[model samples]
Target chain A: MATILVADDFHENRDVLCRMLRLVGHSTISAANGQEALDMAQEHRPDLILMDLSMPIVDGWKATAILKTTSDLRHIPIIAVTGHVTPDEINRAISAGCADYLAKPVDFERLLGKVASLLGDTQRPPFLSS
Target chain B: MKLSIRTKLLAALGLDLALMLILGSFALNQMSAMNEEATFVAAQTIPSIDTVNTINDILLSYRNLQVEYIINVASADKLRIEGEMHHLEEDMAKAFITYDHFQLDENERATFEQTRAGWEQFVTATHTQFIPSNRDSNTGNVHPSFSRLAPLYDNLLSHVRQIKQQSQQRATTALGRVRAAYDASRLVILSETTLTIVVSAVIGLTLSSNIARRIRKLRDATMAIAGGDLNQTVALRGSDELQLLANNFNLMVASLRQQHLLLAQRNTELSESLETQRKLMSDLVQRKQAEEAADRARATAEAASQAKSMFLATMSHELRTPLNAILGYVQLLHLEAQIRGNTDMLPDLERIRSAGKHLLTIISNILDFSKIEQGKMNLEIDTFEISSVANEVIGIFSPLAHSRGIDLTLICPPEIGLMRSDAGKVRQVLFNLLSNAVKFTERGHITLTISHEYHSGKAWIFFSVADTGIGINPEQMGRLFQAFSQVHHNTFHHYGGTGLGLALSRQLCQMLGGDITVESETGKGSVFSVCLPADIGTVQATRQTHVLHTNGNLPRHIPGSVPSLTPGEETAVVASPTSMTQRDA
Candidate 1:
C-alpha cells in the first residue's frame, strides 16, 4: 500500500477521492486546491497524486508541472481528473505530466484501475474484490 | 454714290469712246477742210497760171512771124509766112477768149486787161498800117508801121508776162494755204489722239486699280482664315462686289470664331467629366475595400463566439462536481448501512442518490442542449438489438409506472433486429419519453413499441412511446420541441423536469439521421415516435453531412461483427409493471 494525494477545489470531491483511496488499503491525504496540493506533495512526497485539473489557484496542470520538475517528487505519478472531458483537455492534462487522465464524475472502478496500473501494483483493491 | 465695278468700267469705256469719237470727228473735219483747200488750188489756181503762160508764148511767136514777113523777099516765103502770121493772130484771138473765160485774181485780171488792149492795138496797127506797108515791100511807111507794131508787141508781151507773174503768185498763195491747212489738221489730230489716249489710260488705270485693291484685301483676308487665323476680317472702301464679298467674309470669320470657342468649351467639359468618372471609380474601390474589411471583422467575431460557447458548455459539465460527490457519498453511505444491517437509512440514502442523479441529469441535459447549440455533439455508433433497448427503457420506467399505478409495456417485435446507431442517445430519448409519460400519467398505461421497417429502400428502426395519460394541448404542440419551452407553465411544479429533454431528444434523433414526431388529442392520450436509420454509418456516408466530432474527435464505432437478434431464451423481458413492483416489494 502506497500513500496518495487527492487534490480538488471542492472539499467533498477531495474527501470522496481520499475516502475511496483509503478504502482500497492505500494511505491518502487530501488538499482543497492546487496550491495546497503542491505544498502537501512537497512536504509528504506521496507515491501518487490524483490531481483535479481545475482548481482555485495554480490549477492541476501547473501543480503537476511543478511537482514533476522537482528532483524528489518527479518519480511520483499523477492521475489528472476533471469535469472538462474534451479530448483537448485530456491531451493537455497528460502533457502536463499526468500519468493518466479521467473525466468526472469519476468512475471509482476505472480510477482504481488507472491508479493500480500507474503504480504498478498487482494487487486488486478491496472494493473490486468484494 | 456706289461706283460698282460694272458702272465704273462702263463709264471709263464711255469716256474713252467719247474721247475717241471727238478725236475722230475733229480729225475728219480737219481732213475735209484740208481736202477742200487742195481741190481749190488744183482746180482754179493751176489752170489760171497755165493759161497766162500760154498767152505769153503766143505773143512772142507773133513778134517772130512779123519779123519774118518783113525780111523775106521771095513771094512764096512771104505768102507762107503771112499765112503763119494770120494763123498766129487767129490762135491769139481764140487764146484771149479762152483767157477771158478763165478765173483770175484781181491783180491778174488788171494785168490781163492791159495785155489784151496792147494785143488789140498791135492787131489793129498790123491790119491797117503794117500790112499795107509790108505789101509795098521797100516803102518807108512800112518801116514806121512795123516799128509801131514792135513797140505794141513788146508792150503786150510785158503785160502778158506781168499777168503770168500775177497768176503764178496767186497759185503759190493757194498752194501755201493748202499746205498750212494740212499742217493745222495734222497738229489737231496728233493733240486729240494724245489727249484721248491719256484720258482712256487714266480711266482704265483708276478703275482696274480700284477693283484690284479691294479684291486684294479680300484675298488677303481669305488667306489668313485658311491658315487658321479666325481673327482676320476684311474692310473695303467701295460699295462694289468686292466690298460685299469682304463683308460676307467678316461674317464667316465671326462664325468660325464662335465654332472654335464652342469646340474648346466642349473639350473642357469632356476633360472635367473624365476626371469626375475617375474620382467615382476610386470611391467605388475604397467602398469595396471597406466592405471586405467589415466581412473579416464579422468572421473574427463569430469565431470568438464559438470559443466562448465551447468554454461555457464545458463549464456546465464542470458544474456537476458537487453532484458527483453527493452521489458518491450516498453510495458509500448505503454501503455502510448495508454493512451495519441498518435497513431504515437505506431508503433515505437511496432518495438522496435519486435526487442527486436527477440534478445531474438536468445539468447533463443542459450540456447536451448546449452541445447542440454549439454544434459540438458527437455520435458513438454501435450495433445493438432494438428490442433489448426498448425493454431496458421499459424496465427503467417500471418502478415509476408501478408507483403511479400506470401500466408500462414494451411492445417489440421479435424480428426487430440489431441496428447500427448511437445506442446511448437512443436510450436517452426513450428514457425522456417514458419518464414524461410516467410523470404526466395518473392511471393509464405507457407503452413503448419498437419495430424495424424499410423506408425509401433504407432500413429504419422506430421506437414509439404512446401513453393513455394526460394528453398535450394542440396549441402547445407547435412549441413542443423548443428548448426551455415548458408547454404547461402552470403544471411546471406538478411535473418536475428541466424541459430540455424533448428538444435535446429531437436534436439527437436528427443528428442520428432520424427525427422525433408526436401526436396527441386533448384530454385523451399522446404518442411520441422516434425514427432512426438502422445504419447510421450508411446514412452518414450517403448524406455526407457535418454530423459529428465538434470537439475534433472522430466518431467512435465498436469494432465487432454485428450480432443478430432472434426470439429465443436468450431474449428476456427486462421489466413489466407487476414484476417490477413484486421485485421492489
Candidate 2:
C-alpha cells in the first residue's frame, strides 16, 4: 500500500477522502489546510498528495509551488482537487506544480485510479461498490 | 577758436585787423615827422635867406646913390639922393621883420640884427658926410668923401651875405631828418603784411584737418547707417560742437542698429509662425473632417451595439442559467451512478454530461461573440506567465490531437516572459485556436508558437496555431470569421463545431488590444495567428520567431519578409499516441 496525503479544509470532505483511501487498502494522512498538508507530507514523506485548491493559511497553489520546488518533495506526485476548472486556473495549477487534477464532488473511481497508477500498482481492483 | 568755423573766421579777421593797425600807425607817425620838417623849412629857412639877401642888395644901392650925389652940383639933386637913401633904409627894416616868421636859429637872428645896424650906418654916411655944403665946391674934394662912403657900404654887404649862408645850412639839415622817418615806416608795413599772410594760410590748413575732416567722417558714418550698415561709427576729432554732434550721431546709430536687428528677427519669426499656423490650420480642418466621419461611425456602431447588448443580456441569463442547471443535474446523475455502483448508468450519465458540455461550449462561444459585438466584453487584467498559458492551451488539446493521429507541440522562446493582460481572454482565444486546430487536424502535426516582437516601444506577443489537416479553400476563407459561418455547408456537421470559435477568437483578440489573422489553402494546411498587445515592463522581446512542431521542426516560413528563426528556442513535443473519444476527459 502507498501512503497518500488528503488535503481539504472541510472536515467531512477530508474524512471521506481519507476513508476512501483506506478502503482501497492505501494508508492515509489527512490535513485541514494546504500548510498542514505540506508539513505532514514532509514529515511522513507520502508517495502522493491530493491537494484541495481552496484552503486557508497558505492556499493550495502556493503550497504546491513550495513543495514542487523542494528537491526532496519534488519526487511526490500531486493531483489537484477543485470544484470548477477553467483553462486559466488549470494553467496556473499546472505551472505552480500539480501533476494531474480531478473535479469534485470527488469521483472516487477516477481519484483511486490516478493514485493507483502513480503508485505503480499494476494489480487491478474493483473501484465501485454495489 | 572753439573748434568752429565761425570762431576761426573771426580769429583770422581779428589778426588781419591787428596787422592793419600796426601798418597804419607806423605810416601816421612817419607822415607827422615829414610835415614838421617841411613846415620848418617853409616858415624859417627860406624866409630868413630872403631877409639876408634883401639887406645885402639895399646896402649896395645906398652906396651907389651916395657916389651920384657927391658928383652932382645942384641942391635939389642932393636932396633927392638923401630921400632915396631913406627909402632904402625903410626897405631893409621891412626885410629884418620877415625873419620873425621863420623857425630861425640864434646864429641867423644875430646875423640879421648886425645886418640891419650896418645898413643904418651906411645910410647916415651917404646923407651927411658925402653932401656937406660948407665943403669946397671942388670936384677933387668930392672923390675922397665918395671913397669913405663906399667902404662903409661894403662892410654892410658882407654882413648880409653871412646871414644868407647860415639860414640855407639849417634848411638842408631838416630835409635829412624827414628822409630817415620815411624809411622806418615803410620797413614796418612790409614785415606785418608778410606775417598776416602766413598766419591765414596756417589757419586754413588747421580747419581742413580738424573740423572739415571730422565732418567728413561723420558724413561717412551716417551714409553707412543709411545703407543698413549699422557697424560704422564716427571717430571724433576735437572736443567741440562738432565732436558733440559726432557723439550724438553715434548714439543714434547704436539705437537704430538695435532696433533694426530686433525688427529683422521679429519679421523672420512672424513669417515662420505664420507658416506654422497655416499648416496647423489645414491639419485641423482635415482632423475635423476625420473626426466627423469617426463620430458618425461610432454613433451607428453604438446604436447597433445597444440592440446587440439587449440580445446578449437576454441570452446570457436566459441561456447560461438553464444550461448550467442541465450540466449540474447531469453531473449529479454521474456522481449518483458512481456511488450506487451502477456501471451501466455511468456511461449514459457521462454521455448526458458530455452533450450538455458541448451545448454549453456552443452557447459560451455564441455568448462571447455577442458580448464582443455589443461592446460589453471587458478584459480583467493581471500578470500571468504567458508560456504557462500557451502550455496549458497546448496541453488541453494534446490528447485530442494525439487521438486524431496528430503531433502537437508548443514553444515559448526564453526571451518572452510574464505579461500583464487578461489571461482568461488569452486562454480563451488560445483555447479556441488550439481546439479548432485539433478539431480540424486529422494527421501530421499541430504547432502553437509563442513569440514576442518589440516595435516602437510596444511589445506584441504572437500566438500562432498552424495545422496540417483538412484545410480551407481560398473561397471559404473570406467568411471564416463571420459569426456562425462555416467554411462549407456541411463543415459544421462534419467538424461538430458551432463555427463561432474563430469569430469569437478574433473578437476576443481585439478585446485584448490586438488582432487575429489567418492563412489557409485547400488540401494543405491553415494557420491562425492571434497577436496580443503586451506590456514590456517585464518582458523581453524574442530575437527569433519560430513555430513549434512535434518534430521540433518549424512550420513553413510565413509569406512575407519576416526573418528566419533561431535554432536554439525551446519547444515541448507531445507525440503521445493517446486515444480519446467523446467519452474521455
Candidate 3:
C-alpha cells in the first residue's frame, strides 16, 4: 500500500475520501485546505496527492504548480479533484501539472483505478475487486 | 410735334382741307372774273355791235330809195319816193338816239361820235338834197341833181360801217380775255389739287411708318421679355399713342424683372432649406441606427449578466447545499453499510442513495434546460450499438416496472446496428421516457421499440416508449414538452416529478438533430417517440444554425428559481455514468 494525500475544503468530503482510500488498501493522510495539503505533503512526502481545486488558501491549481516546480516534491503524481466538471476546468487542471483529473461526487472505483494506475499498479485494488 | 395720333391725323386732314379750300376759293375768284368777262362780251359788246350795224343798214336803205326815185317816170311814183325819203330821215334820227344809249369805251365813244356827226350831216343832206331832187323831177324818167346826193350818201354809209367794225373788235378782245383767264384758273386749280395729293401722301406715310416703327420696337421688347431677358426697355421720343404704349411697356418690363428677382431669391432660399432638411433627415436616420445598435449591445450584456447570476444562484442554493456533503456522505454510508453487513440498514441507505440521485437528476435537468435555452449545449457524438443502449435502458426500468407489477418489454431488432449520436443524451432521453412510463402506468405493460431505417438516403434511428398509463388529454398535449409545465397538476403530489424530463429530453433530441413526439388516448395509453439522425455530425452543421436562430429569439431573461446549473451540477452529470455502474454492481 502507498501513502496518499487527500485535500478538500469540506470535512465530510475529506473524511469520506480518506475512508474510501483506506478501504481500497491504500493509506491516506488528509488536509482540510490546499495550504494544509502542501504542509502535509512536505512533511510526509506522500507517494500520491488527491488535490481538491477549490480551496480557501493556496488553491489546488496553485499548489500543484508549486509542487511541480519544487525539486524534491515535483516527482509525486497529483490527481486534481473538484466539483467543477466542465471541459475547460478539466483542461485547466491537467495543464496545471496535474497527473489526472476527477469530477466530484467522486466515483470511488474510478478514483481507485486512477490512483492505482498512477502508482504503476495495473490490477484493480483488493477492496474494489472484492 | 408733341401731338397725339388723333391730333396728328386731324392736322394732316385739316391741311388737305385748307389746301382744297384755297383751291376752291381761287377757282371761284377766277370763275367770277371769267364770268364778268363773258358778261361784258355778251351784254355790252354784242349790244353795241348790233345797234351800230342797224344804223349802217338804214343808211344803205336810204340810198336804195333815192336810186328808186331817180329811176321813176310817173308823178305818183315821185311822190311815193318823197314820202319814203321823209320816213328815212326820221328813222335816221331815231337810230342816232338809240346809239347814244349804249355804254362805250374811250375808243368806242370817239368812233360813235364820228358816226353821230356823220348821221346828222346825212339827215340835213337827206332833207335838203333828196327832197329837191324828188320835186324837181318833172318827168319821172330823169333828174340831173341826183349826182350831188350820190357822194353824200356814200360818205354816210362808210362812217356807219367803221362804227360797226370797232364794236365788233371790242367784243373779240373781251372774249379773248375770258379765254386767257379760264386757262390761268384751270392751271392754278390743277396744281393745287396735285399739291394737296402729294402733301397728303407724305404726311400719311410719315405718320404711319413712325407709328409702325415704334410699335415694332414695343413688340420686340415684349418678345425679349418673353424670351427671359428682363433687361429690355422700349424707348420712344414722341408724345403720340405709340410712345405712351412704349412707356407703359417699359413699366411692365421693369415690374416683370423685379418679380423675377424676387422669385429667384425665393427659389434659392427654398433650395437651401430643402438641403438643410435632407441633412437633418440623414442625421436622424444615422442616430436611429446608432440607438438600435446600442440597444442590441445592452441586450447582449444583460443576457450575459443574467446567465452569470443564474449560475451563481444555482451553485449557492440548489447545488452546494445537498450535492457536495450529503450525497458524498450517503455514498460513504452506503459503502460502510454494505461492508458492515447491516442488511436491515442497506435498504434505507439504498433509498437515500436513489433519492439523492433523483435530486441530482432534477438538478441536471434544470441545468441542461438552461444550457439549451442559452444555446450552450453541444453534442458529444459517438458510434455505439443501439441494442446495448436499448438493453441498458430496459434493464434500468425493469426492476421499477416489476415492483409496480407492470410488464416491461424491449422490441429492438438485431439488425439495428451501430448508430452515431450523443450516447449520453440518447440514453438520458430513453431513461426519461422509460422512467415516466414506469411512474405513470399502474399495471399495464410498457414497451420500448428501437429501430433504424433509411429515410431518403439518410439513416434515422427511432426510439419509442409505448405505455399503458393514465393518458393525457388533447388540451394538455400542447404544453406537454414545455419546461416546468406539468399536465397532471391535480396528481402532482401523488406522482412526483419536476416536469422537466420531457422538455429536457425533447431539447436533447433536437440538439442531436432529432425530435420527440407523443400520442395518447385519454384513460388508455401514451406513446412517446424520439427520432434522431444516425450520423448526428451531418446534421450538427445545420443544427448549429438552428441553435443560433433560436438564440436570436430567446427572451432577455429566463424566470424561475431553478435558474441554472453550476459547475457542481456538471460534476454530478460527469459522475452519473459511474454512479449508474456502481448502482448496477
**Which candidate leads the pack in DockQ?**
1
Colliding residue pairs in candidate 2: B43-B102, B44-B102, B44-B103
Sorted on lDDT, highest at the top, how do the candidates line up? 3, 1, 2
Q: Write candidate 1's Cα lDDT for B368-407 as tens digits.
A: 6556656556677789888788788888888878987877
Tell me the tens digit of each residue's lDDT in model 2 across B467-574: 775566667766677665666656666657766777667566554556677665556666677766685233333211211121212223233322223222213222
lDDT of 3: 0.75
Reference interface contacts recovered per candidate: 0.53, 0.00, 0.39
* Per-candidate DockQ vs. reference: 0.41, 0.03, 0.22
RMSD of each: 11.6, 15.7, 14.9
| Fnat value of model 2 | 0.00
DockQ of 3: 0.22
Model 3 residue A111 CA deviation (Å) reads 2.7
How high is the lDDT of residue B545 in model 2?
Answer: 20
Better of 1 and 2 by TM-score: 1
The all-Cα superposition gives candidate 2 an RMSD in Å to the true structure of 15.7
- Which candidate leads the pack in TM-score? 3
Categorize the docking of model 1: acceptable
